[model samples]
Target: MRDKIESSLESAIFNSRWLLAPFYLLLILGILALFVKMLKEVAGLFHILMTGEGNLIIAILGMVDVTLVANLLLIVVFSGYENFISKLDVAHNSVDKPSWMGKVSYADLKLKLIGSIVAISAIDLLKAFVNIQSTDQTQLAWQIGIHLTFVVSGVLFAVMDRIAFGGKH
Candidate 1:
């Protein structure tokens, strides 16, 4: 009975593989959505700058936000699919998985993800800075606070990664 149940469970998991098909489809949709969002941001910036109503610094900072997010999304989607869900047969045949992918092991992925979030937060702080009408000391203080959070979080992740990997605590 035990053997039979284990075999049945294996079969069920195999059959459930089809459930991931929709997830893959959604991943494609996400890629398209990112593209559309980036284009919209660009167009909005262009219109604002052309009319001289936009701060060029803020507009450029917004572009950086979009670019970083797009890169983060690509890394998560592709590496996640390759590592957890399915092996990339093509990657195996090619020169080792791309450099970024190689570095993003299951252990390393967590640290990298935390670091990326910190980067995103820093970018947001930068955007806020660009919105200054006059040099507001309070705003600058808040920016420093946010940046410190980013720094602490990054250091924590690094320390945790090293500890978990038995390199350094």
Candidate 2:
């Protein structure tokens, strides 16, 4: 009787794993949508620049910002899902996985999030600079402060991660 009960419980748990699969699929789909959005933003930047109505540097910087953000999202969504929630089953027989994938623990993910936030914030600040005619100085200053906060937090996380991981070589 006890054996039968244990088997039933094991089956329940195994079946429940499928529930997480849909969520992971949704995350992958969301990343694809973000990629499309990034392309749209880049195309818009080119359009604005070609029309000679915008500051070229600001437009370019905006594109850079979007690209960085897109990359950050890709790393987080893909790595986090694969590491924490899903079994990616990346081929053992293929080329070895990248070092970053091996090194990116949950702690590292948090630190990278902070760093990405800071970078994105600075990009926004640069965009604001391009719109000096309409942008409030107070708003720009506030963004700068927020960006610095992210930067400092990221640095602290890196230090903590290093100490905890014994400096991950």
Candidate 3:
């Protein structure tokens, strides 16, 4: 009876992974909201071009920032679900499946996340640089400092991963 009770408890614990399924669905909703924001950015871009008032580079960079964030969320959802919850068997048979799908291990996902963050930070810094005329020197300094921190952290993550995984990736 003790053995049966222990087996039942283990099964229940394993099946609790399904509780995370709803969180992934919420992330999908967040992605849809980002899509709407991107549409608004594109519309404003057209108006800016016609009026020739707003800085086009800044507008374009804003869109790129949104795109990068949306992509990061997607990777998290995919890798998080697959790694934590279950396999995405539907994607496995789909022709349009991303090449990276199913291949990103937990370690790889961490690297990809850091790399995306670094890219996003770089874009923000570039935007600040482009608008240096109005940017506060102190704020700019902070941005640079923060971005460098991310860069250093990313490098450290890569180095640690290499040591931990023996450079297998």
User: Which numbered prediction scores highest in TM-score against the true structure?
Assistant: 3
Which residue pairs in candidate 1 collide?
Answer: none
- RMSD (Cα, Å) of model 2: 3.3
How displaced is residue 84 in candidate 2, in Å?
A: 1.3
Q: Give the CA lDDT, 0 to 100, for residue 140 in model 2.
A: 83
Residue-wise C-alpha lDDT for candidate 3, range 19-61, written one tens digit per residue: 9999999999999999999999998899899999888999999
lDDT of each: 0.74, 0.76, 0.95
Pick the lDDT winner. 3
Report the lDDT tens digits of candidate 1 across residue range 1-169.
9999999999998767657757766776777887898788889889887898867777777777777777776677666665666665677557766767644676566666767777877887877766656648797788778788878977887888787769942
Q: Which whole-number lDDT from 0 to 100 does residue 29 have in model 2?
A: 79
Poorest stretch of ten by lDDT in candidate 1: 101-110
Query: TM-score of each candidate?
Result: 0.76, 0.75, 0.96
lDDT per residue (tens digit) for residues 11-127 in model 2: 988677667667767767777787787787778778886797667777678678867777777677656765666645584345765557645768767877787888888889888
